[model samples]
Target: MIIHTDRDLSLSGMETFTPKTFNIPELVGIGAKNIEEHLKLYKGYVSNSNLIINKIKEYEKDPVENVYVLGELHRRFSFEFDGMRNHEYYFESLSDGKKEINKDGELYKKIEIEWGSFENWLTQYKAIAMTRGIGWVILYHDKQTGHLLNQWIDEQHLGHLTGLSPVLCLDMWEHAYVYDYPTSEKKKYVEAFFENLNWDKVENNY
Candidate 1:
């Protein structure tokens, strides 16, 4: 059993998420399905494991002990709830040395404003992806200002898109699908990723 303080859940200083308005998207699409499958495979053990880690990250200072036995009700399903949906991205040229026309693509415009250039953004994204443990490498967007911030998390429980809201997230957690797919074949997983994308939800979030 473990407990987490509000401060730990809030990231460094991102204190805007409230349970009433902060809705987790419905776990749909390949990515969502993968997350669901990952949860089921672990059968709640993962949640228990995270609870311990969350306590270590959040409540060591309290000196109080709380034990919680997560029941079936707390089961984590695929991200399936109203307001939660897959995201969409429009192709933007990643070439260097030139500033091109807007071409009227929503994602292209957003990327330009947030990251300077698509090339620069992707370079940073790839770097984050390969840097650590399994989880996700996300490009979080600030809904108000359209800023892009790169972040990663271990388990969906830990990472926050500091400074910006989450615009995009790529799950790198091995359990997300590494069982059905071999761990060495990440390229295939990346390719299959396109099969279950829900861009409409992402556009709505923006």
Candidate 2:
């Protein structure tokens, strides 16, 4: 595992998350059954995140005696917390309704400034989503540099940029599409995800 970032660390008074509800419409390629199951996994992440924080609090009652336990719990918290957060980004993008990216938006200008054109960025981001593992393809905004960067995160925690925030998140975990596409045809699921995306929601995140 990578060294813990501030987000990966278990804080003394971390608050639990309430799983968010998405107003998702019928989507192309991706079936309703697939979405129903996906949301369940999202909820599991939220509950597990809460459980981990609560467990850390219990272990903290005896910091010296539970040092090892606390250490491991702190490390484990990031996976669950990021899982919850990443899904929120993914699901929200597919929520409300499908719409085209606004060419006039700040996000569009940023994409163009970084990659020369929106299509260039989309092509590269889609290729990144096809990375050979269960992970995420994220578009992050670096506040310090005022730049956008694409990153591939391994297992919900590793590879996140320090001091940056993800404006868009694509879950490439097999579970995200197991009900909609075979492993060999995951590209179709990627296509389906974008087909249903609400770029407005992603812009709001930025």
Per-residue lDDT over 70-178 for candidate 1, one digit per residue giving the tens place of the 0 to 100 score? 2221223222211121111211111111233343668667777777987777668766766557666666777676565787765554545446655556666566556
Model 2, 1-206: lDDT tens digits are 33335443445358777999999899998899988999999999999999988888788777899999989988898999999999999999999999889999999999999999999999999999989989999999999999998999999999988999999899999988898889999999999888989999999988
Point out where model 1 deviates above 4 Å: 1-36, 39-106, 143-145, 159-163
TM-score of 2: 0.93
Weakest lDDT window of 10 consecutive positions for candidate 1: 86-95
Q: lDDT values of the candidates?
A: 0.46, 0.91
lDDT of candidate 2 at residue 40, scale 0 to 100: 96
Assess candidate 2 and give its lDDT.
Answer: 0.91
Quote each prediction's TM-score: 0.49, 0.93
Q: Assess candidate 1 and give its TM-score to the true structure.
A: 0.49
